[model samples]
Target chain A: MAFTLDEAQRIVSIALNHGRDAGWNPLSAVVLDAGGHPIAFARSDGASPGRYAIAEAKAYGAIMLGMGGRAQMARAEAQAYFMGTVNGVFGGKVLPVPGGVLVRDLDGAVIGAVGVTGDSSDNDAEAACAGITAVGYTPEP
Target chain B: MAFTLDEAQRIVSIALNHGRDAGWNPLSAVVLDAGGHPIAFARSDGASPGRYAIAEAKAYGAIMLGMGGRAQMARAEAQAYFMGTVNGVFGGKVLPVPGGVLVRDLDGAVIGAVGVTGDSSDNDAEAACAGITAVGYTPEP
Candidate 1:
């Protein structure tokens, strides 16, 4: 089943709230549907305008690669040329960095992804995972 | 002053709510800052994947032209060559239609623009104006 708009907005809001509570920098969050189309997005008041694009890229990368951000990072290092070429195919929208977490349903199939930015990459990943779990889905961290 | 993320999200939500209340088709809405940067975006469940780009272009066109969608449309009709050239310069991101409304603050200064899609252009503009008014902002119709 597709993730509803309500679920997508919850993922964005919860991720931003988690970043705030953790005293991280202002954050931006984006939720993409299984088809890699954006369902919801929000940039915190003081976040830079570029944060939204970065956040959206993170989620797009994770969804397109069918792996979590960490795995993508590892692949980027091991197959730099291949990864770079694939990123080029997507018009430089694949950011192989932490903070992109895949959302899975009960059957462990990926349904979508949540991306968070505006903090340390590790912290961003933590917030993304928190949001995914809060929505009763497994976060492929 | 800049629009807070809360206000952007509210505009998106209110516009979608209006569309639903009026039994319009599934809708998509986007809000851009005065600098033409995206602040918030949402697409309803059944909207086509292309809806987001179209909605964003509508708002971007209005913000870039310093006028509402209707004005943009009028100019587009009167100056087809100029409008087409401008669209090419922006990588075809301008949609001269009735669904893009400019948001004005108390001083009659433009703050941002909202774009809505998925229904008829007139209906989309109606919802956009409703959302802007709900937030106590004037909508340049």
Candidate 2:
């Protein structure tokens, strides 16, 4: 389940479509490689430049933490001092947000991730999920 | 003597010239802020896709520690350990290398920094200093 440019593009499309359907104006979407590197990104024309950074950060956070936002929130109690030390480490490349998704392969291997922004957290997660599903990969149960 | 984009670009150009002059083809150069943030970057087009990450690391290392390459050389130092730990905690964003130069203004105040890569650490540091000096600033006392 290696993520390619085509799949990342499709993810952006689904996210944008979801945005349109939800009456959200526009957004910037980013897809990260399995190593949490950027694979592809696109903005709906009017999105601000900062959106690009935020989208990348959100997607990166999802992959690095290896869990969705709720799970990340749950684990915060286990690793004390994780938050303060983490920000200085990536030098500001990660964000703690509910907009990133892990893309897994048939064998449950994590291959890549998708992040969506410019809307509410729920809507952003929904758009990312749509894209993940569009690629025929299932998210973690 | 702030580390302007122009100075950053010039550092890359200097480092690139040194590489080409010495027959080190397809090198990369990058400049970063005092906080290990990116300012400018360049690659020889046909270089590896990982060039972005590598160049970024060189720049990050230079800016984060206040001294260039100190972390990479003294890997066992507590400072290096802290830097590496911070990077892992932040998801690989902090990089400590020896090619970063602290930028200063006429009043002898540290304002920003510049970093360069694509050649040996010696050349990387040389070019960074060249660029900083070209902007009418000294590298260090």
Candidate 3:
């Protein structure tokens, strides 16, 4: 299941549309390929200056660690050392604590991730989740 | 003097051409603004898989530390803490060990820097310096 750039762009566009309709201010939506590298992103006009980087970092963590925000926020779900090393591999780009959604194939193979920033962390997470679902992909529980 | 995006691209293109003329493999080159953030980058086909991150790191470090290749490599450098923190900040994305050329404006203001990777570290630094100089900017002494 190749993740086409078009598909990636769709994820951001739809996510941005949702943000607009949801009464959120400007937002940045990001899409990462299976390898957790950036494929596409959009930064709306009113988004915070920090939105772009944080969005990419959160998406990188979610996809690379193969977990959702809720699970990561759970008690002792992952070791700090391991998460730290993963962060190192991502070159300071992985924000493992959530606010992103990992998209998976029908058979449960991880394919991509979506991330949002600008709204509250919870809203950012929801927006990314919405993008994942909109693409007809199951997100991590 | 702020680094314009166009000048950054020119730095990368000149650096890359130097590598190409020397029969080096295709490489990745990056330039970062004064704030140690990426302004522009270019990766030729056949570049190393992780060259992008390396290039960014080098650019970031050079601009942040205000050092050139060999001098930036000094073991006794004072910014080691800042360098280490940068590692934590970017999760290994701020490799503060040189291989980049710091850029200065007419007033000697540190405007930006350029980095190249995908060859020997020496070659990478050399190419980056050559490129920055070609763009009519001073590389650190």
Candidate 4:
């Protein structure tokens, strides 16, 4: 089944909640379905204006590459030249950072991805995973 | 004064509420500050994936051109060749059409712009004006 809008909003809400509870900086969260289209997005009240774009790009890259942010970072390191070309193609939207988390269904199929930005990359990824797990989905981070 | 995030979110919320109350199709709303960066955005559950992009572009164009969507439309008609080059410079984000409304402060200075989509252009513009007026700002459409 395709990702529902409610689920996407819930993911964003939960991710922001996690950030707030942890006393992290204001956050932005974006949920993208398997098709690499945003299902829902939100930026916290104090988040910088660019937060939404960064969060969306993180999720977009994760969903498009079929890997979590860490793996993308590793690949970016291993294949710098190729990644440079890919980043150009994606219009610099492929940020290989730790804030992107892949969501998986019971059958281990990729369903969508969640991206959070504001705090450090590790905290961002932690918030993303928290949201995915709260929604009863596995997070590949 | 700069636009606050709370005001932006309220605009999106009220715009979507107007669309629902009018029984129009699912809609997307985007609020961009004077600097042409999004402060808040939302797409109704059934809105198509591209709604966000369209809504954003509409508001971006209005804010960048210092006019409402109707004025932008007129400019597009009168200066199609120039508009083509301008659109290219903005990376095709200048959608000169109805549904974009300029938000003005009490002193009549442009503060921001709101864009709504997913219905007829007239209906979309109506919804955007509703939200802006509800927030006590004038809508220049």
Per-model lDDT: 0.88, 0.63, 0.70, 0.84
- Identify the runs in model 4 with alpha carbons over 4 angstroms from their true place: none
Question: What would the TM-score be for candidate 3 when compared with the true structure?
Answer: 0.54
CAPRI rating of model 1 = medium
lDDT of model 1 at position A49: 80
Candidate 3: tens digits of C-alpha lDDT, residues A1-141? 745645665677677778889998766777777776655556664454466578878887777678765565552255767666767887877766556777778788888777787777777777777777777777663
Question: What is candidate 2's CAPRI-style docking category based on DockQ?
Answer: incorrect
lDDT of 1 by residue, A1-141 (tens): 778899889888999999999889998999988878888899998898888779888999898889888899899889988888888989888888899888878887779998899998899999999888888888986
Runs in model 1 with CA error above 4 Å? none
Using Cα atoms with residue i matched to residue i, what is each candidate's TM-score against the true structure? 0.95, 0.50, 0.54, 0.91
Candidate 1, residues B97-118, lDDT tens digits: the string is: 8999998787877799999999
| Lowest-sum lDDT 10-residue window in model 3 chain A | A69-78
| Chain A superposition TM-score, candidate 2 | 0.86
Clashing pairs in 3: A91-B90, A92-B90, A92-B91
Q: Quote the lDDT for A9 in model 4.
A: 70
Candidates 1 and 3 compared: the better one by lDDT is: 1
- Report, for all candidates in order, the number of backbone clashes: 0, 9, 3, 0
Question: Candidate 3 lDDT, tens digit per residue, B37-137?
Answer: 65545666555446667887777777666776556566326667755775676656666555677778888788877778877778888888887787677
lDDT score, residue B132, model 2? 61
- Ten-residue region with minimum lDDT total, candidate 1 chain A: A101-110
| Candidate 1 clashes between residue pairs 3 or more apart in a chain or in different chains | none
Give the lDDT of residue A16 in candidate 3. Answer: 74
